[model samples]
Target: MGMGRRPAEADTDPFSGGIFNLNESFSDRIGDYLLGSPNLSLPVADETFSLHPFPVAAPLSTTNQETRASNGHEAAEGYDMGISEQVSATCSCSSQIVVTFEMVEISLHLVTAPKGSPGRPSQAAAMNIEEFLRDHKRALVSCEMLLGCETCSCRGEYVMLVISICRKLLHSVGVMHREGLSEVQNRDSSRERGGLWKLDDEDQAGVLEVLLKIRATRLRRLVTILDHVVTSHDWPAHRSMTQDLVRRLAEA
Candidate 1:
């Protein structure tokens, strides 16, 4: 191909003016807006995170200090109260446990209490007998005193005397069936039983006369009980004693 006189010139930047325009530097217009210097005019950054001069926190005001102190004191007081409540709860639990254990002990003791031995008289029964013996002896003594009074005209006293003597005779015979005669004899060594005379030979007639006037039924009942003691098992020491006492009363 035949060569032309010249080829077309290379494309050039209009802003650069020409391809050899090396005297002007390549200035970035966008970089000026994106990465500006510190002195650039713009809105201020928040002081909280700003580290240019190392952020200095603002000092607390007087009101803020007082509020913080009050909050700390309240927290300490609450802690102390919590400790006291915990201790009280612990003490209450301990006391309840102790009381429960004591009650259980008492219940067990009651359930397992020992029984009294057989054949032996209970303490309460023995006390009752002792009281009865003393009272019976006293009644006999009072009847004997009334029989000695020749001037005493109270019909009630003569009736009580008759009843007392009959009761003693019957009791003397009855006691042998309950226990050995030896036990009664040993217990009543100092106290006279059926042997205690209600009336002397002279007084017997008067006592019998007074009893007859009161009621024939009462006198017959007494004679019947006395006959029973005197005739039955005539060899027993109590029976012999009752027989002697009955003989005196019947003689008049």
Candidate 2:
């Protein structure tokens, strides 16, 4: 799990609420708003259209102080759990775009294991899955087939293939083992950070449902997360409900 380049703001990556600003004593705190985009505002630049970023906040936090206290490991677990839920919502969607996004996020959850965790094997498998998801996402970057595939067949040139954006910090006991992800890997993609987009409601939920279909075990966890996100939208993040369901899974 040794990636090349590094992200520009790797140190400042927002795992919790410290990255947003809402004037509620700390950051933006856009958890509720991000959970379900009522009116998404995507920007068009240089004649290229794409989805927007995750807004000015995270959709799974409350107090900025609490976010500060929680380290990357805890954040990784919580975020992965949340992501699982999102996959379920889109599992039913038949769109390739939605399916691609869900795969990318699930891949992120699998690959983003930090160092020092006793589950290195699990973490390695996760990274491999993440790489595959990214490749799949890249294949769908441009409406025109970037790669020769059954769905699309278009030659390159005068093409604005922005591709996909995926990121995660694998951690274990507060240490990030897999480093140097931002290196100059892809010839087309100079930096480690590639372009990403904020999916709309139907697209977002549709993507989740597709993921659930691929991994049935995810359905239960995703339901728990959906209920939690809908309940308060103003409480601290937790996966206790989902964890209870997963207690039955075994390494066997």
Candidate 3:
């Protein structure tokens, strides 16, 4: 026995109250619409996968690296050039040399007041007198010795002049000693107005004696120096002048 075919409405349009179109293929038309849609063609999956965007950097080439190094070297060379110029200028200034010379001067004065005078002698004053006299004596002795030596360049006339000066100094010393003795003798009368005790005649005489002894000692020293000058060497050219100076000093 053969099977029977379905009814026409049931086979053609069951969902639309049994209505159907017979000309088009539905599955093929749906496939074509999906391929042509603008929304479906966009890359939505790529945008959704990455939430943050990042910038990409390119790698440096060898030529660019070399150019940077050369620029740095040129900058360093310019800095060093300035330093070198400064150093050279400093050296030039230091190369110049300078020298200087100085001279010194000394001055001395003698004290002639008696020890028994109104005012007592200061220790400093006494020391200064001694120092001055010592230096003066040393200078005179050295000059005399130099004149005596044959190797010395000093002339006989110069020695004679120096001896004359010494004689004058000795006269001045004598005058100072006499004044000191007179001052001691008169000091008592001068201080009487102040009610100070007057020194007795014996005391005055003792002070004068001391002054005389000091003068005698100085005279002896001067005579000894003159004798040394005369006997230490022979001055044939200045014999008469030397003798005259010696005679004058001895009389003083």
lDDT of 3 by residue, 157-230 (tens): 33554454455445545654554445445544443321122345455545344433333344344445555555
Alpha-carbon local distance difference test for all models: 0.31, 0.27, 0.35
Q: Which tens-of-lDDT digit does each residue in 1-252 have in candidate 1?
A: 132322233234332333222211111111111122223222222212111111222322222121123555332111232233343433232222223233333332322233243422353333222233223233333333333333221222233334445544334323422332233333423332232232332333332222222222223334545345334424244445445655644442
Return the TM-score for each candidate structure.
Answer: 0.22, 0.20, 0.31
Better of 2 and 3 by TM-score: 3
- Where does model 3 exceed 4 Å of error? 1-154, 188-233, 236-238, 245-252
196-232, model 2: which lDDT tens digit per residue? Answer: 4344434433333332222222222233333343233
Per-residue lDDT for 80 in model 2?
31
User: What is candidate 3's CA lDDT for residue 193?
Assistant: 20
Model 2 residue 238 lDDT score: 27
Which candidate wins on TM-score?
A: 3
Q: CA shift at 159, candidate 2, in angstroms? A: 17
Ranking of models by TM-score: 3, 1, 2
